[model samples]
Target: MRAVIGIGNPGRNYIGTRHNVGFYILDSFAHKNKLDFLPTKSDFWKAESVIDTFRFLLIKPTTYVNNSGLVINELIDNFNLTMNDLLVIYDDVNLDIGNIRIRKNGSDGGHNGIKSIIYHLQSDSFPRIRVGVGKQKDDESLANYVLSKFNKDEINLIDQKIPLLEQLMIEFIANGYEKMLDYFSKESNTNSSNLS
Candidate 1:
């Protein structure tokens, strides 16, 4: 089975926050596909379905952001999934807001969620889609910045790219990952998104 893990904190209190973009993306995709996220024995909300005989599971880790790797590990074992079969969707502050990056594998950079995943799995060889939340302002508290909701302009920026984000997610599902990276990379290049 193929699993896509969207790393973010749980609870209604976190909705619309910059840190919750991962959850937002997964929820949007699930809604588009007519799937409902149901509570699972695993530490995440899960939506399971099959598309053209390919089993797919969408996960939103309820373990919150910092300990995401624990939920990921559990899902892997429960689903008999390998690292290569998983794609993590997450937020990044390095890229410009509304930008997206796709990669087959790499270091977590400074992302605590990714760091947790790498620490738990002891490996970084997995696919990931990073949505840019833009760099924090110099005087802003990192924690405060990420946990805050996107401002009106930022929301407008991301809103314009939602369709493109959907396409990128679907590309991974339809074209498989290796080629999907190339596809997104090329797409980002032409559009100034920098899919690294």
Candidate 2:
């Protein structure tokens, strides 16, 4: 079984904010699949689904982003899930708007949510997808920028990208990270060649 955890603060106030893109992706995916997130006694809302016979869990921690790891640690223990069976999705200030970067394992890159995960897990050997929310302006504080909502154009761009992001998540579930990476890379090359 695989678990996909989207990192974001829980509550209506956080909706549509840059920091909540992780939750946004999971919500969109669940809606598309006709699944509903059921509240757990634990610190998360979970939706379970089977795609192409692969069982996976969609998780949204009820805890705030900075403490996301608490939920993950609990999940790992209770569900018997290893780090390799997990995929974390979160926002990144370092990436340009609507861009995504996937990695098999790495440091948190100063993301508080990721830092918490690493702190609790005691390891970073897991797959992750980072959604880009764009860099903050020089004068804008990091907290302010991340918590801010996207403008009209930015929202449009994000909406356009959601379909592909959904495809990537599906790919991740149907195949492991290495296979997913290679498959998407080849698909990208094929599309580029066709365009050329």
Candidate 3:
């Protein structure tokens, strides 16, 4: 089985914040699939779904983003999942808004959430989707910027891209990261050709 963990703070106050994009994407995907997240006895809520013959779980950590690894570690053990069976989705301030980058494995790149997960898991061998939420201004504190809501235009841009993000996740569920990366590469080339 595979699992996709969406990292974010839990609660109403974080709903529209850039730091909550991971939760937003998972929520959208669950809603579209008619899956409802149910609270577990642990530190997360999960929606289970099957795509083709693949069974996967969509997880939202109930803990704050900085402590996300604790929840992920628990789930990994409970489900008997390996690093290859997990896919993490979270926001990246380094990329421009509306962009997303996928990777099989890597360092945290300064994300506390990823850093925590790495520290707990003791390896960077999982797949991840980094959704762009735009960089913080030089004058602003990174925490304040990430915890803030997006402007109307920024929100709309992300909304438009959510469908594609959902589809990309479906690909991850049905295949491993290699095939998913292939699909993304083809899609990117096609999109680039159309713009040229």
lDDT of each: 0.85, 0.88, 0.89
Q: By descending TM-score, how would the candidates be arranged?
A: 3, 2, 1
Q: For candidate 3, write residues 54-117 as lDDT tens digits.
A: 9999999988999899987788789988888898999999888988788888999999999999
* Clashes within 3 Å, all models in order: 0, 0, 0
Off by over 4 Å in 1: 189-196
Candidate 3 displacement at residue 105 in angstroms: 1.4
TM-score of each: 0.93, 0.94, 0.96
What TM-score number comes out for model 2? 0.94
Give the per-residue lDDT digits (tens) of candidate 1, residues 1-196. 7888898899988998999999988888888899999998778889998777778888898888999998877877887988888889899998898888788778998899999999999999889988899988899988998999998999787777778777766766665788677777677678764445
- Residue 16 displacement (Å), model 2: 0.3
For candidate 3, give the lDDT. Answer: 0.89
Candidate 3's error at 80, in angstroms? 1.5
Model 2, 1-196: lDDT tens digits are 8899999989999999999999999999999999999999999999998999999999999889999999887898888888988989899999878777788888999899999999898988889988888999999999999999989898787787788778888888988788767766776676632110
Q: Best candidate per TM-score, number?
A: 3
